[model samples]
Target: MRTLPTPPLCGEPATVRIELYTADSLDACAYTCTGHVIHVTAVVARAGMDAHPVGMAPDVDRPCGYVHVFPTGTLADEPAELSHPRWCDRDECQRRDQHRSRARRVDTNRPEAFIVDVALVQALHPAAEPMVRLTSVQGGAAASLVLSVGQTRVLRYRLANLLDLAGARPNGGRWT
Candidate 1:
């Protein structure tokens, strides 16, 4: 897993929220948070669906929603573990991973299926906080988004294409 760049401390505490979406819908099962650092948890795919509650499983009848984290600062060196089962026997999950792995190996040159881009959206007042948002790009377009940091903290961003990002590091040094 590749990490994102961290921001310098203004000596102020900030809160960030990351929302995941797929195709036309918001993936309610996925959740993210960014503050002094970024943390991505509950990444549940079909292969790993068995790990989550049946109510939280991605709707196979519909497009799947994937949880992604792109921090303005460097993320942990290792991929965060899913709270649920790590692997599933579902063909869809296997197929998705296979396709993503191949694309990463050939295109992005990363070992994983996704590459996140973290950008500095703003520097709020000492009393003000910031938020982050994540959304899926339609038609597989070049993913780009705006992160609104503050009250309401609505994240407005797109998902970049899947590519290899295993060895890549954030432009700036790691946060921790």
Candidate 2:
């Protein structure tokens, strides 16, 4: 019912043999060269044993540097993002997480918290490219790729199947 931007895929999938993983960089940031990004989403994905992540997200106002008790939405504005990423949370971190772009939790404790963000990101990219990316951060790094809608779909489905094979539940449940 809602819409989420394509996750920001930030790096090259050089290690496709294992799992999609990489770090914070806009090198391979996902973009819709055609610029017609619609909304295809799976709002909440539970059904496994894991501690959901939570934080304030970030929003820097000036050069003094803005950190907080927790994270807030990213301060990296659409206009602020250049071809290169900074070493700060605003650029390297929150930007990749889609904090402001998707209204997603900068700290991303739960996906459900970002339902309202789904409808607010059609105009958030440079070069007239639709801001679409596919990335997931883990262990302080993210692996991104420039994939088509069909590729993303296949990847999502394949991951889902892998979970199924591993006996992980879906929607929200314990692994058996």
Candidate 3:
């Protein structure tokens, strides 16, 4: 039998702030429970060795976790006519396209951003810093929530600072 992350207390659900970066639309409503598996797979692949799967979806019989994804638009999926010289600078268009191509080389068919519930992730991993793998379904391109040791340091430092605040402290600790 597999172990799962303990669910949050009955009335005390936490909120995780997530930022999804993409080339186009930032529609938050696009994320749905249906894409959970694909998104989880992408996250696992991109996160590499450190991350593991957990939780369950009430509606789906298959294993599920807290990570819910919303689609962040990608330039590769955008219409070509939008980039035509009529609306924008030709030079800028070339530069944007070049950058998009480089990103495509890494993750060709997937959305640029993977929207997830960080609070649930935290509930699952507890002490461990969570990381995710963002990749295309075809394995053409990929990115990670954490890219380097330097990034880890920065993230840890920032989290620590956030935790240091009075309201952020767990269990109603006294203000310092």
Candidate 4:
């Protein structure tokens, strides 16, 4: 129900372009979908990361990444079918009402469950490669593992790890 700003297109792949914007000092990422600019808060990675050889890599998997579209202004025009118990006079209720009004103002023609394309990348990794030095006369082989594309689950795991590392708590008092 929070108000967020529209992100301008900064960069994207062949199928999608990403625009980053800030609302209330929080960053939001937006992308184009079927000629409409849709705002997204988070891109959840569903596939796990794969280890690939530095020399030769295999083909990426399908549905390797899914664009989990959070509620956006474009998609806000339609009435929300899903509902939950809301506090009547609390600040949270006021915020929810504001979001509903904002969404009702936009003209989102598609249903609430439409899918959007998203790209995935590894956010964490070693920057410099480890040096392999030999002091003795014996010769040995050293290799480094590179990450593969279409590995969303790995990214999700990494995100969870980061949240834990930062001691972040889930909203609405829900914890897993």
Candidate 5:
């Protein structure tokens, strides 16, 4: 099992709505916040699917960006990840498909490839407050999202559950 920093959260629901569908700035820059270098990757996701639900037994073979925080570092440190999971292999993709009935071609750069900071997201109490500072390195407009309390709770639950399954402690940092 591994350890992680406490996530930043509002602890309660917010009174207003905060929508992050658009980017704030178009500056091509990167910044470090809370000891971590926050930046966007080449990956881009759909409107609301940037962060999807995690399975109880997540595919360990999959890249979740967890490796980035470890002593060994992130997928950027592992060249092999760029090829493995055979994103373009139609056969492999069909075999792993949950529907199992469709043999569709694999698209690696899809929404699933992006990384979501589970702990950081889970700690957010949108009902208590809206607006989160988001930083992306990839060339794109900076964006922010305002989630409803219901949406916030659902995401928090799923992410927290994943952390619990991984034996990763949450809220062990200054934000707690």
Candidate 6:
């Protein structure tokens, strides 16, 4: 039997453990369980543990690890999509997996950002400086600025300095 639970969202803390077992087939060996003359193929290698067939799912609703983890829905006896293969290496299933990848690629991509809806300044740690946390419209953290109370005045001065600079202009003047 295999079990794969949905992974937590980004930045959400979670701990997971997976067990690998090999069962014998009833036809070949006298066992009632449907195991194969073959055991589960070891795909990953860990330092202390034996090689195991385990991997993280790239995205939701997409298959990862074994082929049977997310099998194609069958109509009658054949594969559902004729163009795609019935096995684990099906192209149709692969297309469904197109999303943010867990593994790193050769090309570097920047982290996504959104419009900030809220800006909160709080001292998360008593001994530490204040933190200016920017929250996106979706409520996720867009960015954070750790600064002292004096640094906040500097920021305010910098913004006001821009207003002063713009005031020097004729059209975009003060109060207009």
- Which candidate's lDDT is highest? 3
Highest TM-score, which number?
2
Q: Candidate 6 residues 103-139, lDDT tens each?
A: 2122213343444432324321234333333334334
Measured against the true structure, the TM-scores of the candidates, in listed sequence, are: 0.16, 0.25, 0.18, 0.18, 0.20, 0.25
lDDT of 3 by residue, 1-176 (tens): 11222222222222222222333333121122333434533543353312233343345332223323342223123333433322222344333332111122342244545432211111111243333223333344533342344565687788788877635644455332
- lDDT digits (tens) for residues 59-158 of candidate 2: 4121111112111222123344444322212333333433223333233345432222221122223333333354455656655444544566688799
Candidate 5 residue lDDT tens string, 1-176: 11222222323321221111112322121111222222212121222212212222232232222212322221112323222222233233222321112223333344543332211122112233322222232345433454555677787799888877877753554111
Model 1 misplacement above 4 A: 1-110, 122-141, 151-176
Question: Distance (Å) between predicted and true CA of 23, model 3?
Answer: 8.8
C-alpha lDDT values of all predictions: 0.30, 0.30, 0.32, 0.31, 0.29, 0.31
Candidate 2 Cα misplacement greater than 4 A, ranges: 1-100, 103-131, 136-143, 171-176
lDDT measured at residue 79 in model 4 versus the true structure, 0 to 100? 46
lDDT of 4 by residue, 58-162 (tens): 342212112222444222233444332231122332233321111111123444332222321221112422121112111353323233432445766998999
Residue pair clashes in candidate 4: 46-153, 47-152, 47-153, 48-153, 48-154
Instruction: Arrange candidates, best TM-score first.
Output: 2, 6, 5, 3, 4, 1
Model 6: CA > 4 A from native: 1-114, 135-141, 168-176
For each candidate in turn, give its C-alpha RMSD to the true structure in angstroms.
25.0, 24.1, 23.8, 25.7, 26.3, 19.4
Q: In model 5, what is the error at residue 89, expressed in angstroms? A: 51
Give the residue spans of candidate 5 off by over 4 A.
Answer: 1-141, 170-176
Cα displacement (angstroms), candidate 2, residue 18, comes to: 50
Score residue 131 of candidate 4 by CA lDDT: 20
